[model samples]
Target: MTADDFRLILFTLGVSAAAIVLSLPFGLALGWLLARKQWPGKAFVETLVMLPLVVPPVVTGLVLLKLFGKKGPFGALLERSGIEIIFTWKAVVLALAIMAFPLLLRCIRTAFEEVPRHLEEAASTLGKTPWQVFSRVSVPLARRGIAAGLVLGFARALGEFGATMMVAGLIPGVTETIPLAIYRSFHAGDDDRVWMLAGVSAVIAFIALWIAGRLTKGRHPF
Candidate 1:
């Protein structure tokens, strides 16, 4: 592979990994909440959380752009701090995180829900606090599902193109990931490069899906 292609692969891997790491904590919390809690606005909240899966990726990216553009509230504050996010590598990470969040949350929530509540009750009876039971009993039992979720989320993020393109602008060396690279090479009539990149992406995606399947096979989410 060419140096540029290698750079794209490395950059894509780095940014996608970063996105997953950044999202994992919040995903865990939200997953637990959705799986275990019952509140007045719960249905609305679930719909909101799931909106991204149904919404157009470009629209999601546009919303992010408006929220983080230089003149926008969060963007302006960051701008004063001299940290640019729009169309940067950071944008790529952010797009990946957002785009992949729904799948991650769904898998995590299913994992948590699959944990028998009776086990948590048993832990509580042993004088465990809710948090303690969650940490010691629930999380351990749900590890496989969590792993599956992470793998699936990574795959989704790796394949992300629309939202990422909208937010990150597909800069050649800076933000071009595997999907973007494939698109670019195809347009440039570099068929050989396209095949190489496409093959690389397919292999990675296949591995990810295989692992996720192994982790969650025969486990149906409610």
Candidate 2:
């Protein structure tokens, strides 16, 4: 209702969108690989990918903070380039991407696994390269499921709180998101603001789930 509330909503939406865009390429590649191949370390890789979902969000955030803090190797390198992530808006995106990755990957992998290998083979027989078969036949058939995965991922990003708090401190107009705003509002005894923000988040999440369900046609990813 207030300008600040609207700003938080917009900020959260922007960060969630950025998180989805950042993670999608990696998700697509890993999903296709996991669905189509069985390498020696596949199990290990799968477990690693799912670790964030099972672990405490704070733990994930701590690890990320350590890795991206000023003294950390990556952070130091970035600092030299005049870039910063720790306790900044970028950290919010980082947290959301990491937290949402597993769900996105699961949906995408399942969709890719369901794609008929015979169809790919048929394309190959027609002199289509692997990329062509993937980009054309395989992707087209799996489009609906991929879209579902994206919606789920976006929803997950929107709800992220713990890990985000760890890496991106609640700095209004900078790093604060919907969940963070709710936390601050509740603690400050601003019941009205909290209720409004909660309603907005619930409505957004419901719409996302509805769209995902329709896209997947009530598939497992929902």
Candidate 3:
């Protein structure tokens, strides 16, 4: 690859990493809620968590746009605070995080559910606080699941296109993630760059999947 291609790849990597960093904690928290809690509208909340997985990407982008665009509610708030999300790298991160949340939550919920309740009870009886039990016992036992969730989230972030494009606007060196760049290039008839980017994205996704698989091996009881 040329230096320019390498630069583009780096941009994508940076944006994807930023997105994953932003998404992980929230995803874990949401997943824990889904797995450990039962309340009114819990099923609705679970469905909401998975909404991004089923919604059309363009529609997702439109929803975000309406909520966060320059004249939108949050957009006005951020504008008042002198912070902007539209047409920026932060916007890309936001879009990616939204799209990746479902995968991360799914992985983490599975991990949380796999933790035996008896163990938690045992820890509680030993005077360990609930937070301590969660931090020391539950989370430790579910590290592999968390890792898998992270990888899946990262992969989803990496492949995010429509939402990123709509939010970030395909500005090169500013908001053009690899997936968005590929779409732009293809539309502009830049076959070489399009193919190269497609291959690069595929390779990156495959690597993430491979890492997830290796981490999951022998970790699940089944």
Error of model 3, residue 14, in angstroms:
1.4
Of candidate 2, the 10-residue stretch with the lowest lDDT total is 213-222
Off by over 4 Å in 2: 218-222
Best by lDDT: 2
The Cα local distance difference test for each model comes to 0.90, 0.93, 0.86
lDDT, model 2, position 163: 97
Per-residue lDDT of candidate 2, residues 27-116 (tens digit): 989999999998999999999999999999999999999999999989999999999999999999999999999999998998998888
Scored by TM-score, the top model is 2
On lDDT, who's better, 2 or 3?
2
Candidate 1, residue 98: lDDT: 90
Which stretches in model 3 have alpha-carbon errors above 4 Å?
A: none
Can you list the residue pairs that collide in candidate 3? none
Per-candidate TM equals 0.95, 0.96, 0.95
